[model samples]
Target chain A: MSGLAETFAAAAQEQRGVLIGYLPAGYPTHETCVSALTAMVRSGVDVVEVGLPYSDPLMDGPTIQRAVDASLAGGTRIADVLRTVESVAATGAATLVMSYWNPIEQYGARRFAADLAAAGGVGVITPDLTPEEGGEWLAATAEHGLDPVFLVAPSSTDARIAQIAGIGRGFIYAASTMGVTGTRDRVSGSAPQLVARVRTVTKTPVAVGLGVGSAAQAAEVAGYADGVIVGSAFVRRLLDSAGAEPETGVRAVAELAAELAGGVRQRRPRPV
Target chain B: MDPLPDPSGHFGRYGGRFVPEALIAALDELERAYQQARGEPGFTAVLDRLLASYVGRPTPLSDAPRLSEHAGGARLLLKREDLAHTGSHKLNNALGQALLAQSMGKTRIIAETGAGQHGVATATACAALGLECRVYMGEVDTARQALNVARMRMLGAEVVPVGTGSRTLKDAINEAMRDWVTNVADTHYVIGSVMGPHPFPMMVRDFQRVIGVEARRQVLERVGRLPDAVVACVGGGSNAIGMFHPFLPDEGVRLVGYEAAGEGVDTGRHAATMSGGRPGVLHGMRSYLLQDEDGQTVETHSISAGLDYPGVGPEHAWLRDTGRVSYRPVTDDEAMRAMALTSRTEGIIPAIETAHALHGALVLGRELGPEAVIAVSFSGRGDKDMDTAARYFELLDGPP
Candidate 1:
């Protein structure tokens, strides 16, 4: 079974909420990234997403882009990122490699998936890889026991949602906004509506991402999603704590994650 | 023969595949396809037919005698790119890519535009090919160039307003690149200029080189030898390179690149990267870029949206470094004045982006004298700039 499916299954049975934390692999430095992931896992992060930096990170917000740029400038490579994942996975926390499709295509999808699985990565969240073009990677990922997650935006049609959910193995990444990933003043109005729409299609766990930057936003999204993915906010905290104590950044994210996880756990079942 | 721009795609230290690992295979595939297509007679014939019939190529080399007389009687030949279908040289590259896209079995076309010229051109090609088209444009540009936006929509393109950072050309490009990354399977990104990573810069340049190829042949056929100088405006520097590449080996034929000096270079408002900027990497390649201390791209302003860019193409950088081309700045006021002069004398209203080259031609003409033949690439028509021109000249106050 895919590690992502196993993890989600385990979380669903235990009624334990999932906290997905994203960190650019080489931010500050590659050596620092290992410690960062370890700290995130130690601080109650259920799943750690190691971002593979790209030069043109179009879907990212300013904070994530800054982290990507910093990681890229620090000379981070795919090999280094995988190594970081291996080190983080040694701690027993699930690891997910989050990157754009270009980097994966450059690395040869099958080889990359096999290497990622060998490195102990549980899954991948390639936000830019559409389901229509995901056959090779999906097959490779399935072989490696690494789940290939797909994103469904609020604007995604019912047919697209069904297709994505049908093909997706780990969990459905629900983008909260119509545009790129970032922190916003409010969660998209259609996000909850879309989640309800997606629920009608498949039983797959849907993780809401993008604009879930604060505890309030995360909690709000967690009310509807099976998992909550916080990217830009955590990346921003890392940027703020750069050259300072890295644990401070990890702790801040941990507190935010713990708060949101509490909200998901406390959700009352709808009257049947 | 040129040895620098090898099959691997390095243009004299300017162009190469600087993309991340995930896209290497796609780039390699594209490179192979482009190589195969370049050598195929059928492919070339089809492209040629489209260029000739669809884009109305071999755009006239009009001798602007009246404008020449105004420039102190200096000989000025305008490579009339304005007469091309879609009213710009942008169509030439778009049509070539559209053909390639069709051959690749891609049914959707996506493009990024600053002033909407490339978007319109791409939309036109997509319409001709019966392909789905999406164009990303900065919100600011969409507002400034609304008529072009409507024109693109009329050509069956869905215009997506990019409301990202600065809401301009750079943001539009970022969004377009994002779309390409997500939709790489059935979509081909028809990049506008000689920029971007690896194959895009090289491919776009090859498509645009037709401009210089025809211009060079026409100049030679008309004057018996190469003109003394070739000049064109540089934004991402595609048009400049299109006019300069064929004449690179001709030592006597000086190439001049004119850049937009928004207010003035010292005022920190100009888009003249070669004149006032330093070498830095942006949008995939290292080139002369306008950037902050933190390496962030800086905001640029020009009277012409098409010319307002923070970086010049890598080839232009190499040319500048090699001293093969002289890069100079023309102020917004100067370009406007030149536009007026050209319209009045030659009855051809040039886009403000192209007027930079016109301004440069007038300056160089006086210095080189009337006997010196000069070819200036008139990159696009001024119709799209009519709104800005009306505001600039206060035509709204009186005209019905």
Candidate 2:
């Protein structure tokens, strides 16, 4: 079996908490993307998610959209994104791509899956690709040893949660709200309950995303699920430091990840 | 061969497929079906019967003598497309495409609309034909054109409001294209106008040709000859093409297309692509487009709901370039005034889109003189546009 999912699962088990980190590829510049991902892993991020920029991303809030626009303006393509992943994987950090469906369709699904897998991408998390429509993609992605992650929203029913979890191999993404992804002052009201409900279904690890901005929210979600994913907050940090030196943005994300990792490490159970 | 739109489907240099490899197969299929449907006797018979009985075709060519006298004594003939069933020429193309979809063994029809006119038309035809119908509109449009949204729902069509960028017509088109790409197996995309990738432009034109075909026969029977000038508004240019196609070979007939000048072309706030825009690619066709330097579509403004688009049909570009038809702009104030002028004088409330054509006839008639016979297409009725017109004219208050 591939060590990707096991690596994540083992980290969650050992830390008695979830590992979460984010990377907006081609942020500042594509030339520094690989180094950023490497810095994220070296700073103790368990799993890394590289965001693929889309022209029109309905699910993203302002902060992420601005980051995506900057990345696109810098000429980031799926090829460049996967190449960055390959370079980062050489340093041994498991990588997953989070993107909308348009670019994947534009690149041809089978070819995208094949190339990403070859570049050491472990999985893909497309917020918009529903399971009923993802059967062909599921087969294609599975063929290349790349797990296709699925998202279950608070609005999703128990049956839907199970259905998504069944098709999902990597961690199942649990959306914190009914609205698009954004930073929030607090974790969603139904997020913990939704994660708990998903636990009753397939044994797939659940990771709550969308609106979890601070280390406190990440630590809180670590108490419930396998992991917590932060995107908009990290993207905002990068945008703020855009005019500054290149390493500033990378160091910012790494600092946030280290802080969140510290919180998870403090609460984690001792391994048998 | 049609002398107006060449066999390659160029109005001059306007309409041709400028799409990726993924859509090429579908475009080719549509072109083949359209070409076959053109020469098929059964196809014409079915379309003709639908236009006659269902859509109430052979709409009167009423000589608007009162309105004519008001327009400097110029003779004006109204091609009553508004009198067609469902109160618009949209039904003509919708009914034809619905029939084609049924014949093609497709069980579902998908369409995208801006003001919901095309959605209502497609819904009505789908209800008539017992086919599943889905109409996508921008969320903003659904809110503004609520009555038409209700009309589509009442006709048993599923109305999906696209909530993407700007929440308007262009976004709705993008969403509809995505849906089509996903559901191409059993769904037939009934494009609303003579835009989009090839085959759609050609197919919609063929479906709408009845407008020109009937107007020609009606003009010959009524006036004993073709009109000296034919005028219609151009958005996606469907209604204009319907009225201009058959007369393309008629050397004596002069064709004029009216574009919407929202404020004024010089203010850079108009939908007058043919009048003020440059050649570019948009919505899968190369045409006269209102686009920025980066080829991003700019917002188009027009008082007329249907004519508010940043780009025009490819065929219209060809027609403008080849000098086969002259394109001019009618400002918002001009269209609104013409709407009231036609409504009060002729007791016919014309759609704002068609009012642009009437505004053109008012100007062209004086230039052509008293003996000039002019036919202007009344594309749709104004009932669907009462809210827009009432607000524009401030008719919310009691009589002025």
Candidate 3:
């Protein structure tokens, strides 16, 4: 099994949800992002996704969108993303890349897989590239022995879930809602049902993402999901704090990651 | 001669549903609804009546004798899409999609607009159908095309200004797509152009096909022969595809699509996707996109707000690759010049988007000489653009 699969397996054995955190590379600055991921890792995040910023992020809400836009304006490139991934991966957490498909398509999928693998990256989360259109990417990831994670939403049918499960390698990301990634007051009521639906088709571990912001929300998701994925919340923290003090921004993300990590480790017990 | 996009919505690997999983079911539902609606007798009857009465369809084909004489004596025929209700060809697709929304029992209609033409058209359709309407326009476009904003509001549609990510057509699309994802149950996203994920490119084209269908029959009946060439400007490529689809089988008719070249193609300040881009994915479809080396979509510039987009429709990419159509760029200077000449000679003012086609047609007319019968897709009227045109031409006396 791949290291990513092993991480999930270990988490399963521990009988607790795994906490996964996401941050865009070169957000604020390259060095700051590298330190941010390190701080997140130190705060008990079991895995980290270093986002490769793209110009058009259709699936992201305003928070991540603003972070990525700033990263791009700061001259963030694929190289910077890879460098951040390498530095973060050195912390021993299973590191993945969260990105749109175009950059990889432009970067040559095979070359991207090889470069990412060399950087200790274990997988890629492609928000836009469906399994139906991921033939070349699938082959490249297979060749590099890296995980090709795919997302399944509440709108996905059983057959569609099966098809995605058939292609997914690391884990199946289950979107908690039907909208773009952002912090919501409440996680959608449909998330647990969707995860249960996915479980009916594939044994692949399901990680719930989108709208997971607060620790309480993470704890709620951790009760039902194998993994809790938090993104826009962390991005919002960094963006809000970076205005005054960069160190405060980094500390804010780390503290939130730690709180979410605690939530995953000690999930709130549901009433009988 | 082939059915371009197969069942998977692929046009030679260009068009497909590359959107997030949240939008998949909505797209599938739209596809199913469109498939059923297109074949329903009741649906077609209402659509046909609406097209004739509400949209003022079967818009005339005008022979520009003076303009033709000015074009080195070649014959120029204008497919008067500019005369359509709401002053642009956008109403055709807007009305069709609005009716589709009505059929699906959707209460709200959402759309994204570049120059606000599509927003106004969608607002007009939603008003006619008694559905609530909202539009997302880039902050820059809303500022530039303020009159169109007023027109949309007057039609009872609310306009949301998108201030994120370049603040233009692309951002507006992103914002609208987000809205649809969040409100998929009660709202329908009426994509203005023939772009985005699957059903949209095909659906919008199907709605707008009346342009080519009418122009083809009119040209043959009036001129006693097929036109030598057809020309249209391509932004997201709705009008061009509409004007070109029915003529695809006509071997003798040459289809040319002109893209907006802001300064010049060589100057790196243009929206000529075909001329300046490589195949990539943006706005849910794999098409020729203007993006940087890092695959970040770059900001595009054009004097015409409608043409300032970083990507073209997937079908246009396929048509260009297949050599069934020719794509070229027209600089702002050339398009503006053609707009002035068209207004002066034909006494018909054209939207800046249409001026790109006029510029291309003028060049083609000069090349083909007086024997050639060229058809130009006059996509929109210039009343909304009079402010920009007057400012550019120094015709404005003072700040209004």
What DockQ does every candidate get? 0.07, 0.04, 0.83
Query: B58-168 in candidate 2: lDDT tens per residue?
Result: 888889998898666779999999998888899989998888888878899999888788898999999999999999998878887889999999999999997655567
TM-score of chain A of each: 0.91, 0.93, 0.97
Can you tell me which runs of candidate 1 are displaced by over 4 Å?
Answer: A1-42, A45-252, A255-272, B398-400
Residue-by-residue lDDT tens digits, candidate 3, A1-272: 13777888998898889899999999989988888899998998888999999988888998998999999999999999999999998999999999899999999899999999999999999999987799999999999988999999998988999999999987899999889999999988899999999888888899999999988888888899899999999998898887677899899988999899888887775433
User: What lDDT tens digits, residue by residue, belong to model 3 across residues B245-291?
Assistant: 99999998999999999999888899999999999989899999998
Runs in model 3 lying further than 4 Å from the true structure = A270-272
What is the C-alpha lDDT profile of model 1 across A148-175, one tens digit per residue? 8878775466776888889887787887
Give the TM-score, chain B only, in order for the candidates: 0.97, 0.95, 0.99
Q: In model 1, state the lDDT of residue B8.
A: 58
lDDT, residue A94, candidate 3: 93
TM-score of each: 0.69, 0.65, 0.98
Question: Candidate 1: deviation at residue B358, Å?
Answer: 0.1
Docking class of 2: incorrect
